[model samples]
Target: MIYLVEHFYSIQGEGRYIGTPSLFFRFGACNLKCEGFACSEVAPDGTVVVGCDTVYAVNKEHFSSQWGKITKARELLNILELYELPEKSVDIVLTGGEPLLYAQDEIFVEFLQVLHQRGHRICFETNATIAVNFFKYEIYKECIFALSVKLSNSNEPYKKRVRGEVINSIATNAKDAYFKFSVDAESINLGLEDEIFDITSHAPSADVFCMPVGGDKKTVEANTPMLVEFCKAKGYNFSDRLHIRIWDANKGV
Candidate 1:
């Protein structure tokens, strides 16, 4: 079964395709909590939850009420129709707590199959932990991947967050792919360069883009100067969390 946390039509807010008019499908659940990033929310039950900025999407126990359960590819297709988007012109971004968690689901694969058949460009904004079997799911070969792989800053262990073999596979097999790391001032001071270099080494052909880690506009602002300089020093591209910048702490944007 596939679960969709939310769907919206918005401009691509980060990475290679930033600002492009796009349709977003945010899936629920993820393998990593990324508590190190330190974004938190209090649930109705008075439990404090922590993780990456999209904690609501990750903590299903608290936010499942907002997620739409999907049983068929047609249902998603119908959701797309409501937007009345131009034929195959808008970029389709598959994002999540971790969208590829559903990689093997029959319905998930069917949705990708139909999207590809219709000529829409698909991009997966993933943490790069879950590697799709591109040989079996050949349709993924036609899509781009925004590899938002986690760093030590995420508080996830190296073995859990960084997968060298999986990184290489996606870079080598995907139609196009790139690395996008979420960094902060502290992580930058803590030798993030070495860690980032080690991961990117696994995918030599992919370009790297770094964006400040933040859940709100203020935090993002605080981290930006350092990250911009960091990117400049490393000759990497700098991406902004434009969605957060524009719609701070708001859902369904």
Candidate 2:
């Protein structure tokens, strides 16, 4: 069964595909806590519920009851039917909580095959830690991988967050791929350059993109200029978190 946190049709808000109208499939479960950036709210019962923007997708225990356990491809496809596409072709993005955690999954792969056959352009927003066994699974080759390699700002240990083999696999096998790093003043002050040096040392040719880390328009405004200059000076691409600017990090894009 494929575990899904939520799915929606919204414009691409980050990376090279920014501003493109697309469908998003957010899979549940993640390998890293990245607890430093957790957000919270008070429920009707006055319970303090805390999590990241994708907290429901990350901490399964907190949100497990809400997850959609898709046992069949048609059940998943029925959700896509709501989009009412221009044709069978449309841009589709798979995100997470680390959607690639199911890279080796059988039912998920079957669903991917059907999607590919229908001409949907698939994109995976991944943390670049889980290695794709490309030799066994050919569906991965049909998708574009937008790798967001974690940095010290996430507060995750280096070994758990960055996996060289996975980055290498995505770079070597995906239909196309690029690197996107979440940037903030804190990340820059904390030797983000050093982290980049380590990643690029291994995968030097990958196109690098930097997105300011923020939850709301005000915060995005505060962080954008620094990230822009940082990207300009370093010759990397600057990405805008358009979704936050448009909706202030609300649920369902």
Candidate 3:
């Protein structure tokens, strides 16, 4: 059974598809906790506390009670129908604490088939650690994969998070995929260019997006200038965390 986190409609705020109206499905259970990069906190009284920038769906300890259980594929499809808005064609964004952790190829392929039949676009926001053999399935042809590669700044051990082989496989197989990197000024100062070049060496065809690690407007504002300068110097595409800027880290935006 798949452990679903949350599903809602929101604008695609990061990566190449920024500012697009889309339906977001946030699945639970991440392979990586991303400890240092603006994470939830724990209280002295044993309560799990989160930062102001985290979305309710992502702050598992606080919001787990409200998550819906979606067992059958038909039930998930029905849920998609309920979130369909008027006037704009919707794109389905499958995100996660790590959605791929729970989703198997068979279930995802079947779901993709149904969504494709109805003319819906599919986008997978992945951490690029899991080796998804999407080429084996027909649904692979109809999806846009956004491979967000975590860097050293995230505080996740390299062995646990950055698997070069798996990332290479996705870049080699996926029809359309983009490489997005999360960064901060310190990371850039410590030589983000060399790290980015290493990533680009693997996925040469993928478009690179460098997004500032912003959880609030203040952080976003603080990081923007340095990120812009870094991007200009290195010739990388700069991305702003628009949802956090507009909503100030509000959930389900």
Q: Cα deviation in Å at residue 51, candidate 2?
A: 4.9
lDDT of each candidate versus the true structure: 0.90, 0.82, 0.75
- List the candidates ranked by lDDT, beginning with the highest: 1, 2, 3
The model with the greatest TM-score is 1
Can you write out model 3's per-residue Cα lDDT over 100-174, one digit (the tens) per residue?
765454565677789888887888888889877665675766778888888888777878777788778777776
Candidate number achieving the greatest lDDT relative to the actual structure: 1
Task: For each candidate, give its TM-score against the true structure.
Answer: 0.97, 0.94, 0.89
> Model 2 off-target regions past 4 Å?
41-51
Error of 1 at 105 (Å): 1.0
Please estimate how well model 3 matches the true structure, expressed as its whole-model Cα lDDT: 0.75
- Model 3 residue runs over 4 Å out of place are 41-46, 49-63
Looking at model 3, residue 171 earns an lDDT score of 75
lDDT of 2 by residue, 1-253 (tens): 5798788888999999999989999998888777655455444445555645566688766567768887877777788878776764778899988998888777788889998998889999999998898779988898999988888777788999888987987898889899988777767767777788898665777888899877667777888887888888888899999998999968796
Q: After TM-score superposition, what is the CA distance of residue 62 in candidate 1 from its true location, in Å?
A: 1.8
Query: Which residue pairs clash in candidate 1?
Result: none
User: How many residue pairs collide in each prediction?
Assistant: 0, 0, 0
